[model samples]
Target chain A: MERQPVQRISKRALTLWRIYGGIQFSILLLISIGLVVATVLWEWPWWITAVAAALLLIDAVVFIWIVPGLRWKRWRYEVTEQDIDLQYGIFIITRTLVPMVRVQHVDTEQGPLLRKFKLSTISISTAATIHKIPALDEREAERLRQSISSLARVAEDDV
Target chain B: MYEPKRLHPISSVINFVKTLKDAALPLLLVFVLNGNIFSGDVDWIPLLIWIGVLFLVLISGVIRWLRFSYWMEEGELRIEYGFIFRKKRYIPVDRIQSLDFSEGIFHRPLNLVKVSVETAGSTGSQNAEAELTAIRREEAKELETLIFQEKSGYVSTGEEADDADIEAAQSPREKVYGMDMKDIVLMAITSGGAGVVLSGVIAFFSQIMDNLPIGKIYDEILDWIQIGVLVVAFTAFVVLLIAYAISIVLTIFRYANFAVYLEADDLIITRGWLEKKQMTIPINRIQGIRIDENLIRQPMGYASVTLISAGGSVLKNDEHQLRMLPMIKKNEIQKVLKMILSDYQMVDEFKQPPSRSKYRYMIRHSWLGFLAAVPVSIFFFPYGLLSISAGIFLVFLGGMAYRDAGWNAYDTQLTLRSRIIIKQTYLMKKHRVQAASGIQTLFQKRADLSSVKLTLTSGGGAAVAQCHYLEEKDVSHILNWYLSSRREEKPAES
Candidate 1:
């Protein structure tokens, strides 16, 4: 068996994640503001509002300034004739292997954000779960899905 | 065979009981509101209203029974049923996945059976795509046989074809195991259903409490709760004990006459007292067999065997991933495993984690318990020494988890024994394993340790077995176990 070659998601994924992170932080900011208002008007515990604001600040910093870069660096995937391996997560660094024979089907998807960046996400489904290869170039995503399905069929036939 | 047939008249009664069971919660709520909140007196107006409601429900039940008709037409089982609105569904005999025969208390006296029809793609409230509330047992049997005969003709490739071979073997009908009273008690006490049943018991009792003379008694008990601390603790302990006893009794009655038999290429599991459920799972469709032991069961040296079957024998939300043996002695686990699935056997030697892995395991397992103790320790700072003992005990539990956690790969099936609060020993075949991987955490990487995870395709979901804090090389070996199978033998047929 050859050593499985691992590949990373598109570099543009970092920019897309930044935008996604910005949206998330805005929601958190709104919730934090509401908590502050409740604390002032309703005479809620000062500590409650303080804790909420502190947590939101930490979250915003991590999401807007840190996580996207770390997540992009950590996300690596390899699809072989035998299996699909996905390595992800910042703190955990999880490596998951999905055997080709168990692959029921594969699909390439695009949302407004991903489509805008010329990137697509491919989801590989088995009987139980859907494993995703996120943010590949549109053409590359299609090619991967085609090759994976063909390989999966061959594996299925062998079984 | 082309002629349509109606459900037995007894089906109206069964449907009535079903409606009552479904409407039980609302009925109880209404009764409680009328009795307690509305007025103290029980008057004729409410009684008349209740009677009228029952009459309407009974009429609907009768209408449903009158409308429902099924028959074999064009070699397909065509069923048409509706009270106000009618729809028809025809299922090809070859596509019928499994035919289940059940007899609740209502159907038992009449010698009638409830038939549930499952297909390859059944996604509904109840897993069964279609059901016949009441039919003759012999008629259900004939229908099942007829479908099987037709199904075998076209579906004779994998599992169904193997059943054809087992037809010759069916005559003997070997009795594999039967649960005795001792085993029943052991299983009942060890059953994890206590949590689910306990809540149900509380709900039932609370509803009863609202209307009964026991209301004043519960009020006095609540008065005692105002005393707080020791009273609360004592009450909680008593309630827990009562719940445990009730759950055990419930389990014993539920699995009263548990028995297993191998007929052809299918294993037949029969259990329950009030509601007898008979399920037949094709042996070939079984994706994996698991020997599971939770916290309570493990301490008593008992483990249960559950089968994971794909694309067949679905009943009630669960029972599809049915328990083959509820509780057997830990030592007897391997014996039972071999008896049921012969291609694999248990191993005496397991791949143990490194000695230092114990410390990591202790920290990982005990952190939550430790965090919980922090509050108690803070609140009772003047007598905070009381909380230190709990912390120490939790630490000891973590050590025990480390002692328990290990892995063993025997031929193709990997048996992993891992402990958190609950000690679970999971077994899965290499081929059945859908995925496997190894991860190295920042701490683990620095310590030259890695964790392994194995994912198996379970009934409608994925079950994962993971071992944390192992030698990097060992973790890698665990990852490759699925891909490197050399002795992956098919389970021996009975």
Candidate 2:
């Protein structure tokens, strides 16, 4: 709708999402292994192990392989002096517009993992809602937070 | 007005009652846990502790009342409170939005009123802004006038100017709307309050059941199974009827003599029979208006209008007051709304979804019902076939929803109408929209269908207005409308 937001997030965000997905897939892998061990110990149906293996395969492909790339492809955002436009979501594309005048504040946050990846997430807050743009380059996130906040202050419109 | 003043002496009593109300549950627990007093096996220790706690609570209420003092100093309302912690709050007069006045039974006979300071700064806070439990009516009026004059940059010129200012302040407020007896009765009868009361009654009964010898009763009930079924069903019906009656009476009490008035820039709503309430909402603070028509009311051609305001404290204590025109004939909404908020116009025609979206709506609404029907049909067999009727009804409702769901952008205002159970139409100005979004799922993308949503700031949170399964172009049109307005505002700003 309205030609999705013009700017794309940092390219490394793709690798970051895949890494996050990999961690989740590894957790599921361990769980499936536990199920296989239980199947062996209890002499459970062989199909139980088969189901667990099939689940692990599906999770590995969907989460670690397919979803991250698609998500990275979908994520897009653009900030103008007047408004902030965001378009994201893989299967369900959502395009949002937040007028700069309504923005209350802006913040850039980076956790341990994000810090290691040199990525930061910037959140734009209005009086009633919060919009977050995740996995931007750390410097870009900082710049965006400062620019958005200054623009918000200059906008000076009250609810 | 500058002197640090205490509330009326009756405030101590009001404080005592308020504290006791909050402690009622724990006190009841203590009483119930203590051995049966009727059996003369009462435990003296818990009883003594209870009495001591009650006494302490009473004393603390008095101390709290005694310690509380409020004064206006250097363009701010300064409030000093707390018996031990000694809390102090200074609210700038500029941020003080409005003063809400209400009269409880305690305040009524004594010619006193409770004052709640509604401030712009109270957003996201659970507690309401500063409250004066009980104050003289005249003092409250004077306080309001002082705040008003200070806010408006007018200096009071002794007693004569003060009197004149109060008169100016009390100048005839145009009576915009009033609910008649018939409409109030109809609104109460059709309200969803009965369901809430019925649930409460069931909860209370469950609590009572927990203390009863249910196993014995169950065995006895089983022995009389056939007759017991009829008796239980009849009793349940009677309980429902009773709950419904109680809710109707309560609604009537709450909405008795409800009226709306327009004074300068504020819309004042006053209602209630037992405890009177008066709330003032600045016209500018209103973000949007939501008209709700539940299944019953819609069929009856009735609807309720609620103002989405930006004041957090306005949401506290009986938000029913915010329902500006609680119940009016659907057609009459425009007439009354014109008097209060002339900027909003009712758009009778809307861009309805394409005919192809009808089945989608039906599937969306009835999928869960139909899903449940499968298990019911399997478990109950022949009788369970009737469960299919519920799913059919939902499907029918879904078709109606598809027909009802529509969106219209008229000038600077956007109206989005949608329904699940309660049909709601939100009328919002372009400037008030905090965010707008267009959403398209994989299936909808293939079908060239999308949903459009807009968010408006309401009280401490946000209210979303959405119309689903619209043509993709229609969704884009709304997004463009929202975006274009921002561009339009830019030229004016420069």
Candidate 3:
């Protein structure tokens, strides 16, 4: 049998996605501040007010920038003719490999946001794990879905 | 064919009586508390009411005791039960998971044991279930042996090979993993801090009225104490902290001697010092594995393993659908996991983390939780500082949630790791997933990100594990993986 080459996933739109996430996190921070102010005005103790506000601010900043950076650093996935390879982590990187023959089903879904953006999410489910690709354009998602389904169908016949 | 022995019919009454005795304390307490709270004018009436209720309960219990009867006919286990409503449930011999025989301290004198047969059913309708309160010990053992032999035979014949094949195909039994007593003790001792705190609060409130100083200038003194409440509050806080620690210690002591064993295709767990329970889980029924690392366990390199199963019965107190393994070291996880799942391989080598952009949706996910907390805090403002504190906690929790969101997928496997205080990694195989779903809220649509969920079946039912927000190209790749066909089996690689 010929050994297959490892395929790497695309990283084209990741930076834009990260920036959007940061903006959403900033909005959360604003909401947290509003909550703290409302609480402090309602006769809460200064210590409680201070702690809550600080935690929320810390949380928002961490969510916006730090978390996304960690995730991006960890995310790596590859698909071959016989198997799929996924590697990801922020601090503790982990790798997993699943054979093509084990796939039980495949599905594609679009939420309101993805719909507006003309994007869809693809999900691959095996007996043990559910792997996903998020934010693909409509045509790309559909094409990938067709290819995977064909592959899965062929795999099923062999099983 | 072996002749099936007939069980003594009187055992049903004894079991019903035992059940009544176990239920009596709570029922009596409810009546007493209600009487004390309601009917202050006539105390004797309340006493009479209690007597009347007790008398009725006794009569009903006796009737139920007389009504229950079970027998094994051919390859079927049959039970005729109920007092007012008669029910007959017949279960085939093959459907029985295990027939358990137990003897209470009281039943020992009578040489009697209780017999319970468990089956694979998620609805928890105890249809193929029967409890023989006090049957002869010899008879109980005979029944157990009969069921065990049947199971052993079925297993030997490769009928139970769905589970056994996984174990046999993967590795040797010695190489399979499981937890020891030390791990169980560590898990119980360090894991239940929140439960300890909650129990302390309940204990304090229950005894609060007894401790309060009543009469004359009590109201005046209370007012003064409220003014200097900060000092008093500090003292109270210290006391509560001590109480919490004690409760935690007591809880650990009470739960000592816990053990988990991986025997062939079964995961057997035994725990509790006073009221010991033995639970046997079939490997095939395990829906998924959840590896959780809390702040306390992370430092020790320990992670708790929880098995998600649809067949197990619910515990009486909490509605937790998953059974926790308590604590095990990260390095030891693979060994223990192999015992439960023989065919699955553990990917021990670390790969480079995914690009940072994968976390964008996690931050967005946290905002939804924060958004929900704002209005709730405003509505409960009258509770003063407590309500405000709760609001703050929610926002903090949401922030922590963002820090925890991340996903990792390998060739045919995917793992979604997330947490706030308690971290969890959901592991599954791509080919075994039964369904996939994509969802997005209106706001998420504008962000061009959507949530992808995949459903996988274990035994009879399914579970959906998800990843939120990824780029369009990534979604396509994942979908392609799912739709991709299986390849022929290659030579096994170590």
Q: Which candidate tops DockQ?
A: 2
The per-model lDDT (C-alpha) reads: 0.75, 0.87, 0.57
- Candidate 2, B1-494: lDDT as tens digits: 78899999889888899989998888887887786789999999889988998899889888988999998877788999998799998887878889999999999999999999987742333433798899999888888888888788875645334566678766689999999999999999999999999999898778777989878888887677768878879988999999999999999998998999999888999999989999999887888999999988988999999998877575655568789988999999899988888889988999999999999999999999999999999998998999999999999999999999999997788999999989999998888888999999999999999999899887777889999999999999998888785665532211
DockQ of each: 0.45, 0.57, 0.05
Candidate 3 local distance difference test against the native: 0.57
TM-score of 2: 0.93
lDDT (C-alpha) at residue B198 in model 2: 100
Candidate 1 residue-wise lDDT, A19-113, digit = tens: 99899988988888988888899999889988987888888789977999999998988887877888888888777888787787888999999
Cα lDDT for residue B3, model 3? Answer: 39
Candidate 3 residue lDDT tens string, B188-264: 55765656676756665665555456564475886776775787688668776776667666556544555666666
- Across B1-494, the per-residue lDDT of candidate 1 in tens digits comes to 34688888999988898899999888877776675535557666886898899999999999999999998765588999997689788887766667878888888988999898866542111232688999998778667765775666643333223445546323566778888989998877777667876687777767665666766667687665567668757866787788889889888877878888787767888888888988876665566666666877777878787776654336335752388888788787676667667765655577888898887877776677678778877987756757767767777878887777788875677878777667766777766666777788888878878888877655456667777787887777777776664234433431
What level of docking quality does candidate 3 show? incorrect
| Model 1 residue B397 lDDT score | 79
**Which residue ranges in model 3 land beyond 4 Å of their true spot?**
A1-159, B1-42, B100-114, B122-127, B131-137, B148-185, B196-255, B312-324, B346-400, B456-463, B486-494
RMSD of 1: 5.3
Q: Report the candidate with higher TM-score, 1 versus 2.
A: 2
Candidate No. with top TM-score: 2
**What's model 2's lDDT at B322?**
80
